[model samples]
Each structure stands twice: as structure tokens, then as C-alpha cells.
Target chain A: MIKVLFFAQIRDQLATSELRMPSSENHNIEMLLSNLKARDSHWQTVLSKTNLLVAVNQTISNENSALQSGDEVAFFPPVTGG
Target chain B: MIKVQTTDFNLQAEHDKLREKSSVGAVVTFSGLVRDINQGKEVSSLTLEHYPGMTEKSLTKIVEQAKSRWNIIDCTVIHRIGELKLSDQIVFVGIASLHRQDAFAACEFIMDYLKTEAPFWKKESTTDNESYWVDAREGDLKALNKWSK
Candidate 1:
């Protein structure tokens, strides 16, 4: 399983902070996102935001980044911290 | 040093700690306060939320990057989470170096990158009881690009 994390506005919108996804196939970040979006309409709408940001293992990541079991993935809006 | 805490920090104590090394000659500190107003709205308070483990890791990396790019002697980053009142201190970035320019540049670099790369969100509560998530500004992303080239 891979650890999926949600932060900031995404967390508030989805009403969750983290969850575990079953490991299957050679899914990349994009695939992971699509899978999450399939959960419900609320997930679909919130995850589909144009400005959505992602990270893999604490590093900023993109859709093409491949995922592996045990990896920690994060999704959030663009940061506004100082 | 990097800390993610809900409690407010002491600026003078943080400065004293950063400047303790004899090699340090210049110290630069930047403190961010929760403002009373934003975008013409009277904000009553702000709720700062962050991913716990990742927030510290991201902050440490930012400080490491700053150390690599400049001749900084030491650095401290403290970010507060949870509810904060108007005008309350929210964040602090302090750098100590042998020269003023490096300290200044490193301090600014950390702040800029922290705003873009860190996983933090601010929700502002207006005086009228309406609360909204603060959107990331275009200018923040632009500020980070200045450091890349």
C-alpha cells in the first residue's frame, strides 16, 4: 500500500488528511489521482482543480512521476506560507 | 534549526541563539505577522494548517538549500500552526553569517521558497464571520523563479 496525504484546502474540502491505497500495477502520479477521483463526485471536483499541486515523498512532483508501494504521496493547493 | 510549533516564539531569544557562534558577524531576521486586514477585508483571525511530518522535512530542505547557496553560519525557521489572532506572529526566518549580504539573501531566499514549496494553507476569518481559504498568489510563484536563475 502507498500512503496518500491531503493538505490545506484539499484536506478541508475532502474532509480527510490521509489514506492508504492498495498497490496495483505500475501506476504513476496521474493514475493515482484518477483512481482517487473515482471515489466520489466530491473527490472528483476537489481533485480536479486546475491549480492542484502534488508531492512525492516530500518533494514537489508532477503527474508523470512514477509511484511505488510504501511511497508517501501528497496533494494540496499551491502553498501560501511565508 | 527548524521548528513547526503552535506556540508563539521569542524573537530576541531566537536571535541570541543564532548569533552565538563567534564566526557570525551579521544577523538577519524576518518575522511574519498575521495582519488585521487582507484584500480590503477585516480579518478577525487566521487558521494555519500544515502537514505535520512533511512540513518539517520541507523546511529543513529549504534551510539546507539556503546554506548551500550562501555563506550562512546558522539558520532558524519557526512556523506556527493552529488558530492565530490578528497581528499575532506566525512565522520567523533568521539567518546568521559573516556578511550582511549573504544573511539578507539567504533569509529572503528561504522565505520565498517556503511560500511556494511548503505544504501550508491559511484560512482567513473575516470580522463578519465569513471564513475562506486564502488562495496562493501569482506573485509568490514569481518570487521563487527569481532564485532559480
Candidate 2:
């Protein structure tokens, strides 16, 4: 399972917070995003913007980056990180 | 020394902590404040957020980098977190070195890198009933690139 993290106002709005989903060899970050948006309407609203950043582990990730088992996926609005 | 805390810090006291006996002839500091306005948005307060463990670790590394790159005597960095009001002091960086040039240059260098490399995030709450996360400014990233080792 892959670990997904959250932060900011996004974290403020969460209920259960963080998740572990079955890892798939064929699915990349783009697919994971699509799956997340499909499962949760809240995610759809927060991430509908194309600018949302995806980080595999702690580093900013490319859309096409492949997901590996035990990877941590963090999806947040374009990192306003200072 | 470096600290990331929610308590408001005394600028002078923190500075004095680094004033121990040594050959250091210069001391420099940089403070970041929560301003009243930004691009016409009337900001009433600011909140600084950071990844707890990662932030302290990154800051320690940054201070070490400065020590290696300059002939410095002492350094102190204190950053405030949680809720802060308008004109409230948010962050402070202090550097002491043998010469003023190294002190000034390294202080700016640390500030610039802290702005970009550190995992801290700022959100501006305005009187107009809007809250938005401050975007990482392009100029800040550019500033760090200029001093890239």
C-alpha cells in the first residue's frame, strides 16, 4: 500500500486524514490522481486545478512518475512552501 | 543555535545569547515581520507552518553550511510559528563572523535559502474575509540561485 499525506487548509478540512491504498505496478501518479478524484468529491474540488503538486516521497514529482510499493504520495495545492 | 517555536522571542535577548567571548568582531541579523499590507490586501495576521522534524533538521543543516562556507564565530536562528499579528516579528536570523562582509553576505544567503529550501508555509489572513497561502515568489528562488555553491 502507498501512503498518502496532506497539509495546510487541506489538512484542516480532512476527516479520517491520510490513507493507504493498494499499490499498482501499472498506475502512475496521474492515474492515482484520477482514482482519488473519482473516489472523493472533496478531492475533486481541492485538486481540480491542474497546478496541484504531486510529490512522491518528499520531493516534487512529475505527473508521469511511476508509483512504487510503500511509496508516500502527497498531493497538495501548488506548494506555497517558502 | 536554531529554534522553531510558537512562543514570541526577544530579539535582543536572543542576540545577546550569541555574544559570548570569541574573536567575532561583527554580528548581523535579519528579521521577517508580518506586514499590514501586501499588494493592497489588508492583512490583519499571519500564520507560519512548517514540517516539524524536517524543518529543524533542514535548519541545522543550513547553519552548518554557513559555518563551512564562511569564517564565522557564531550564529542563531529563531523562527516563530502559529498565529502572529500585524507588525509581529515572525523570524530572525543572526550571524557573527570575523568580518562584516562575511556576516552580511552569509546572513542574506541563509535568509534567501530559508525562504525557498525550508518547508515552511505562510498564510495571510486579511480583513476582507479572505485567506490564502502566500505563493513562493519567483524573486526568492532567483535570489538563492545567485548564491548557489
Most accurate candidate by lDDT: 1
Which residue runs of candidate 1 sit more than 4 Å off their true CA positions? none
Residue A78 of candidate 2: its Cα lDDT?
A: 38
What docking grade applies to model 2? acceptable
Instruction: Compute fnat per model.
Output: 0.84, 0.33
Clashing pairs in 2: A82-B115
Cα lDDT tens digits for candidate 1, B1-149: 89999999999999999989999999999999999988789999999988778889899988999999999899999999999998899999999999999999999999998998888889999999999989888888888888889
Worst lDDT 10-window in candidate 1 chain A? A22-31
Best by DockQ: 1
Candidate 1, residue B90: Cα displacement in angstroms equals: 0.7
Worst 10 residues of 2 chain A by lDDT: A73-82
Model 1 pairs in collision: none
DockQ of each: 0.80, 0.38
